[model samples]
Target chain A: MIDEKELVIALKSQNECERAFQILVNLYKERLYWHIRKIVLNHEDTDDILQNTFIKIYKNIHKFEEKSKLYTWMYRIATNESITFLNKKAKKKNITIEEVKNQLIENLESDIYFEGNQIQILFQKAINTLPQKQQLVFNMKYFEDHTYENLSEILETSVGGLKSSYHIAVKKITAYIKLNETI
Target chain B: MKRRENIDKFKVPTNYFDEFENHLLNKINEEVLPKNIGFKTPTGYFNKLDFNIKRKNNSRLKEGKLIPVVSKKTFMYAASIAAMVLLVFSVLKDATRVYTLEEIEISSIENFINEGNIQLKQHEISILFTDEILNNITSNQSRLSGNQLENYLLENINDLNALLPY
Candidate 1:
C-alpha cells in the first residue's frame, strides 16, 4: 500500500495526481460504501450515495486540508451524503425519517441481496428503529468497529455522548431483537 | 480449548450470513451500480485519474489536428460580414442624424419648445374652470354644513330624499 503522505504529495504535484487519486479510491471506496450503506440502507441507494460521495471527494480533493486523515474526511462526506439522501427522500415521500427507514427495511427484506441474511436483516431493522443519531453511533461502533475517538472526529460529537448514544441504541436494538426472537 | 469448542455454536459462522451478506458484498463490489441507485458516481473502482488525464489531454491533440486554414477563412469571412453590417448600421445612423427630414423637423420642434416662449391658453382655461367648479363646490358644502335643510328634509321625507340627489 502506498503511504498516505506519499500519496498526498503525489496528488499535490498535478502530474500522476490521477494515479494517486485512483489509489486513494481503491483504498477507501468499499469501506466508505459500507459505512454509507449502513446509514442509508437499501443496496441500490447505498451504491448511488457511495458513487456520489466519491465523486464529491474527487472534485473537492484540492480543498482537503489534510488536517485529518483522508479516510475520516471521506467517511464524514459519505455519512453526510447518506443522511442528506435519506432526508431528501423522506421529504419527497412525505414521511418521517423513521418511516423512510422502515420503508427501506421493508424493501431490504424483499430484496434478493438482503433476503438471505436473516440475522443482519433483523439487526438492521432493529437499528432502523433507533433515532438517527443513535443509529449512526451504533453503526460506527458495531459494524465498523471504529473507536470512540475516531467516531467523535468523524461525527464531530463528543466521545462520551457517542458512547451513551451507542449504549442506548444497543439496548433498544437488543430488546427489539429479543421481542422478535420467537418469530 | 473446551470453552473454545463450546463457543463455536454461538460464534457466527461466516457462511451463515453468506447467502445474503456475500451477495450484497459481491453486488457492492461490482463496478456497475444497481438501478434506482441514487448518485451512481463510480469512485476509485477503476483508474479514474488515468482516464481523466487522457481525456483532458486528448482535447488538445484533437484541437491541433483540425485543419486551421479553411476554418480560419470561414471565420474571417463571417467576421468581415459582421463588421460590414455593423459599419453599415453606424454609417446609416450617422447619415440619418445629419440629413434626415424627420430628425430635422423633430430638432426644430425641440428647439422651438426650448428657446421660444409659448402661452398655454387651453391649460389656463381648464385651470380656471376647475377653480370655479371647486369654489362652487366649497360654497355649496359651507351652505350645507351651516343649514339644517338636509336634516329637516331627512326628517320630513323618507325614500324620496334618499333617492333624490342634492
Candidate 2:
C-alpha cells in the first residue's frame, strides 16, 4: 500500500507530482471504476467518467484539504462526476433523470458488458426504483461495504442520515425483490 | 408427569415471533439477492487504465501549455481582424445604404420642416439655381418632351401645380 501522506505530498510537489499521480491512478483506478460503474450501470460511460474522475483528481489534488481520507475524497469526486454525467445525459435526451436510469436498466438487457443473469438484472431494476441518494447509499453500503461514517464523508450526509437511508434502502430493495420474484 | 409439567417452561418474550417472520424474510431476501451486480469491463481494462489516464494527463498538460502561448497572439490577431472587419462592414453598410421614399418616415420629414432646417422660400430656392438650370426648367425644348409632359400631367393631375416652376 502506498503511504497516502507521502503520496499526497509528492502529488502536491512539482517535481514528484507526475510519479505520484501514476501511483494514485494505479491504486485507486479499479476501486473508482467499480464505484462509478455501480452508479452509471454502463461500462462505456463508467469508463468515460472514470477517466474524467482521474483527470479531476489530478487537477485538484493540490486543493485536497486532507480532512477526509484520500480514498473517500476520491470517492466523493467519482460520485459527483457520475451524477453530473447522468444529469447531462438526461438533459441531452430530454428525459427525466429517473427515465434515464430506467432507460439504462432497459439497455442493460442488451449490454454485452452485463453478465448478470435475470435475477441480477431484476435486482438492478429494483435498485433503479430507488431515489438517487438511496441508490448511492445502498450501493456503497451493501455492495462496496462502506461504513456509514465513510459514506457520510463521501456523500456529505450525516452518519445518522446515511444509516437511515441505508436501512430504508435495504427494506425497499427487499420488498421490491420479493414483490417481483414471482415474475 | 407433574414434575415434568413443573419444569420451567421455555420462557419466550411476548411478540418476539411477531417480528421474526419479517426478520427471517429479510435475511432470506438478502441472501437470495445476487452479491455481484455482474458488471464487467473489457479484457485487460484495468491494466490499460492507468496508462491511458497518464497519456490523457500528459496530453492535457501539453494542451494547457500550448493554449496560452498560441491563444494570446491568436486572440489579439483575431480580435484585430474582427474589429477591422466590423469597422469595414459598418462603413460599407452606411456608404452603400439606399433609403427608399417609404423608409423616410413622414414624421421625420414633418419634424425637419417644422424645425426650419429646410424652410427655403420659393425665391431663395430659385436663387440657388443658375440661369442655365432655370432655362432648362422652363424651356419647352428641354429633356421632358411635350409627350412626356403630357404623360406626367395625365399621371399626376392632382400634383400638376406643384410640378410647375412657381
Candidate 3:
C-alpha cells in the first residue's frame, strides 16, 4: 500500500510530483468515480467530472493544508465538482437541480451502464425526492459506509448534523419504499 | 409487597416506548434499498483514464505559460475605442461625405448580425419605415416564388420552427 503522507510529500516535490500523481490516480480513481457516480447517476458525466476533479486536485496540491485526510479533501473536491456540473446542466436547461436529477433517474432505464432492476430504480427515484444534503448524507453513510467523523470532514457538517441528516434520510427512504412497495 | 409495587412504579418517557418499535422497523426497512446501485463503467475505462489525464495535464502545462494576460473584455473595449477614433477621423476628413448601401459589405452586415447587437422586435423594425415604404419593400421583394418558398419551408421546417418566438 502506498503511504498517503509519503505520496503527498512526493506530490509536493518537483521531480516526484508526476509519478506521485499517477499513483494517486491509480489509488483513488475508482473510489472517487463511484462517489461521483452515485450523485450524478450517469457514467459518462461522472467520468468527465472525475477527470476534472483530478485535474483540480493536481493543480491545487500545494494548497492542501493537510488539516484533513488527503482522501477526505479529495472527496470534498469531487463532490463540489459534481454539484457544479449538475448546477450548470440545470441552468442550461432552465430547470431546477432536482428536476435535472429526476431526469437523470428517468434516463437510467435506458442507460447501458445502469444494470439496476425495477426496485433499484425505484430506490433511486426515492433518493431523488430527498433534499440534496440528506441525499448525500444517506448515500455516503448507507452506501459508502463512511463513519460520521469522516462524513463530517468531507461534508463540512458537524457530526451531530450528519447523524441527524442520516437518520432523517433513512426514515424518509424507508417510508418511500414502504409506500411504493405495492407498485 | 410494598417494595415490589414501588419497584414496578418506575415510568418511561411519553411515547418513547411507543415509537421504538416503529423506529426499529424503519431502520430495518432502510436496508431494502439495494446497496449495489447497479452502476458500471465501460471495460478498460479506468485503465485509460490515467493516460488521458496525463496527456491533458501535459498539454495544459505546455499551453499555460503562453496564455495572454489581458482579459477579453479589455481587448473588446480597446477595439471599440479604436473604431470610434477611426470613425471620428474619417468624418472630420470629409464633412459632407455620404455612403451608399453598397459601400457596406454584406459580410460586415452578417458579422454585425452574428455579434447579436441588433435585438429589434418585429414591431420595432416596422416602426423604422413608413407604411408606404414598408408596402413597397414587401411588394418588391418577391425573389422567392410561392413554390420555391414552400419547397424551402418543407426542407427546413424544423429549423424555421426553432427560430419562432413561441
Best by DockQ: 3
Please give fnat for model 1: 0.00
Candidate 1 chain A: worst-modelled 10 consecutive residues by lDDT: A112-121
lDDT of 1 by residue, B1-166 (tens): 9999888768663556644654454334322212222222344633553354345445645775866666877899999999999999888785544566655677776677668655557677577676779789889878765337644543454222123111
Candidate 3: tens digits of C-alpha lDDT, residues A1-109: 8888999999999999999999999999998999999999999899888887888789888888788889988898888778777766786787889999999999999
Interface RMSD of 1: 22.8
Summarize candidate 3's per-residue lDDT along B1-166 as a digit string, tens digits. Answer: 9999998999886777876776586578776767788888999999999998888777878987777788899999999999999999987896677879899999998888779978768898789899999888888777769967745654555222223221
Better of 1 and 2 by DockQ: 2
- State the lDDT of candidate 2 residue by residue for A1-183, as single tens digits: 678899989999999988888888888888889999999999999998899789888887877878888888788778877877776677678787889988898898899999888888889888988999999998888888888778887788998688667667778887888899897
What's the C-alpha lDDT at position B42 in model 1? 45
Q: Candidate 2 — which pairs collide?
A: none
What DockQ results do all the predictions give, each relative to the true complex?
Answer: 0.02, 0.21, 0.23
For B1-166, candidate 2 gives per-residue lDDT tens digits of: 8787767666776666875776566566677678898888899999999888888878888887843556677899999999999999888786767989899999998899889988778898798899999887788566777867754554455222223221
User: Which stretches of candidate 2 lie above 4 Å from their native place?
Assistant: B1-28, B67-166
Q: Docking category for candidate 1?
A: incorrect
True contacts kept of each: 0.00, 0.58, 0.58
TM-score between model 3 and native = 0.65
Alpha-carbon runs more than 4 Å astray in model 3: B1-26, B67-166
lDDT of 3 at A17: 94
